[model samples]
Target chain A: MKIPILRLERILLVSIQVDLTDNDAMQFQSDLVEQVAEIEALGVAIDITALDVVDSYMARVINDTASMVRLLGAESVICGVQPFVALTLVEMGRDLLGADCAFNLGQGLEILRTRIATRGDTRLSEDENV
Target chain B: MRMSELPPAQIPLHETADVVTARRAARELCEQLGFGKADQTRLATAVSELTRNVIQYANHGECVIENRSTATHRCIWVQVRDQGAGIANLEQALTDGYSTSGGLGAGLPGTRRLVDQFHIESTPQGTCITIVLTKPL
Candidate 1:
């Protein structure tokens, strides 16, 4: 399924509510990256709270997506990694999901805001006035 | 290949979606087997990686989950089998950072660490992998 990416100010929000197939994960990656570039988003928060399982493939997709977003000059944070999921991912490998992470969407947005503010002048011309 | 007398919950793997089906079956079986949330996630993640390998390499496979609780031991047995070209390098495949599919190379090795027992057999004709998680009843 194509995951919805919502825009809130200069940040992009994506909540993955279902288990994504390999194809869907890849599609989501491209969609988010393209959208980030298109909107000149300052940050992206990918909330995976609803995901109960994150395998190696999905971990790779999330890691790659985060890197791609950062490559586009946007901050990215992965939020709501469940306790069990976190333990499982670590057991699976070292650095399975190597993106910045938060306990939840709220903390993710806070980190994004702090990061964007710290960077200061990177905001788009349209957002600069605000 | 010691298994329970009870019929295993079998799910056929033909495509990517089957990965999720197999994972859910494993998780549900774990829950029914009375595993805690941590164990449930571990087994589910392990099943997910195994099923994905089946699709990516074998093109087709089947996931079988069974309850193997004995009088003194409680265990969950899972078997994933495929009749496609088997893994060529068992050693390298188990090594971390060794992936042929542009993956993170953590699938096989990572799965081994997640469960209590892991066994794999492969031939040019096909491959079969069995993993087990156990706890005191």
Candidate 2:
């Protein structure tokens, strides 16, 4: 298989823009295990919105991405996974506890917003005291 | 091999959880026919890939599963048929990485990988893919 070329950029001071689902086979490919480092923390978004079911390969990639981000001290959040894909994951018994994922765009943004805001709050309190 | 007509086993709908439903039926049948688990999964994956395509692409389809004990090996046969848009160039379509859609196009080739023998026939009316997996010597 040809390498899955990726485009990454900074967005909103948090979360990198990595468009994984646009063309070609539409999956992030089975090679994402090796490519997880590139998207760690403010990690790349894997769009599972179009897939009706999250197959075994996909579940592995997503899990791997999430774990990589956490290891790098950054949180990974998945966005736009459809309900059926979620169901399939549950049925197939994939655990995403070490990572974070959202069913919709709003939820993903909320995860980012919460993390960024919490960090900002900590910094603000430190400044006020010192 | 000459085409010898064999009785077709008509399975029920409770089995077709998706396109791969026939594979499950194949496993059950394989077990009953004394085929090993590993051998059963191989045949099941093959049948599943074909049956799934039939269900996903065709309005309706049926799985004809056959098991025959031979002198050399215990052989399993499966044919999944669907009355849908037949592939224009079936050979090319069966080629790896040649998808007409967002799918990875691994069904037919993957099916072939799982089985010892494979055959495909398609027309404007529909498609019929046959696969056979055999036990070890």
State which candidate has the highest lDDT: 1
Candidate 1 C-alpha lDDT tens digits along B1-137:
24455588999999999999999988987887778999999999999999999999999989999898877777899999999999898998999989998999999999999999999999999999999999987
- List model 1 lDDT by residue over A1-130, tens digit each: 8899999877999999999999999999999999999988999999999999998999999999999999999999999999989999999999999999999999999999889988984563355666
Candidate 2, residues B1-137: lDDT per residue as tens digits?
11123444565322235433455567777777677655665565556556656655775778888766566666777777878899888888777756565454555665566567888889999888878777753
lDDT (0 to 1) per candidate:
0.93, 0.55
For candidate 1 chain B, the 10 contiguous residues with the lowest summed lDDT are: B1-10
Q: Scoring model 1 with DockQ, what do you get? A: 0.90
Candidate 1: residue A117 Cα off by (Å): 0.8
Docking class of 1: high
